[model samples]
Target: MLVIPAIDLKDGMVVRLYKGEMNSAKVYGEPFEFARAFENYGAKWIHIVDLNGAFAGIPKNIEQIKKIRESCNLKIELGGGIRDEDTIKQYLSLGIDRLILGSIALKNPTFVIEMAKKYPIAVGIDAKNGNVSIDGWANTDSTSAISLASKFKGSKIETIICTDINKDGTGNGINLDFTKQIAQASEIPTIASGGFRSDDELEMMLSDKYISGVIVGKAFYEGWINLRDIFVKYQA
Candidate 1:
């Protein structure tokens, strides 16, 4: 599995939000610096989320994203506030390796199907106790994560980013059972996100054939985990 580093941008600064809460964000550093550091640490892919845009319903960190794109060779997978074809086209043109659709994937799945036909797209399913949450985790939907993921079984989605909000930013370790269930339900290569605590947890995730990758945020940022060490250990 790929040990992808997450760079969550809020107001042009790199940060990590507690449980997807906008007001609970902790600023890290500038985007360019973090991107460069991640590249130096052997990151082949970088996961970025525009926290501001996720809540505002439109991208708010285009300039910072563009700067990061120009600053490194790492493949970037961006999400948050990307709700239209025009925005999808614009980001891909700006050199994003992949675009992740969260809210639209739940609210307008047909649009996601159409976009998946044209661009490299993935669906971001944030869940709280198996139920899907949207609008930056501000609201909960009646659908379960597994049910939603199963709906994309025949679609062109490249991957599924499954995040457990309860475990996010808590350093509590990933919810392996929950992640495995989604992977099994969708038959999609899943990238596990949230509550990545240690190397052992990462090893377990990599061992699972269903898990394709992992997105590490607070663990990497707070020195709880070392990117270079993880790269050497997993060699994914």
Candidate 2:
């Protein structure tokens, strides 16, 4: 599986939120520099999220996002504050490889279906506490994560980014059973996010051909996992 590094933006600064909580965020360095760094380490795809915008329902880091897109030839998959057709169009026009839909997917199932048909290779899902959360993980609804994933059964959704809110940024480990269940239910490739502490965890997931990718944030930034070394091992 391909390992995608995460660059979560909150107020134009790179940060990581534990279990999607704003108060628990820990900031990193410059976002553009981090994007460049990931590219330098041979990353083909970079995952970015606008934490504040996701909650506010507006594009918070458009300027920073545009710079990253223009600076590198690397592909980017962005999420946060993406709600309707217009926003999706705007991001796609700017050339983001994929668009992740969190709260929207769960809140508006009909819109999710229509959007999946309208934009191919432009949709992903992030669920919290086994249920779908909306407004940037600020509110968790009653819908189960698996049920939300099943909504894309016949859509053009290529991959779903599943994050266990509890383990996110905790450096514990991924929710393997939950991920497998979602992967199997959706029958769509999944990108596992959150709580990865070591290369061994990544190696184990890579061994499973069904998993499409894994998003590494705190681990990569805090020197928990070496990108170059992990890339070498996985490549070999």
**Top lDDT model:** 1
Q: Tens digits of per-residue lDDT for model 1 on 47-151?
A: 999988998889999999999999999999999999999999999999999999999999988889889999999999999988999988999999999998988
State the C-alpha lDDT per candidate.
0.91, 0.82
Runs in model 2 lying further than 4 Å from the true structure: 121-124
Model 2: lDDT equals 0.82
Q: Write the residue-wise lDDT of candidate 2 on 1-236 in tens digits.
A: 87888999988899988877899889887888988888888887899998888889888899989988887888899999888888989999998988887777777777877887777443455566787667877777788888877777767776888888888899999887778877888888888887988988887897786678888899988898889887767744
Please report the TM-score between candidate 2 and the true structure: 0.95
Model 1: what TM-score? Answer: 0.98
| CA error at residue 85 for candidate 2, angstroms | 1.1
Which residue runs does candidate 1 get wrong by more than 4 Å? Answer: none
- Using all chains and alpha carbons, the TM-scores for the candidates as numbered come to 0.98, 0.95
> How many residue pairs clash per model?
0, 1
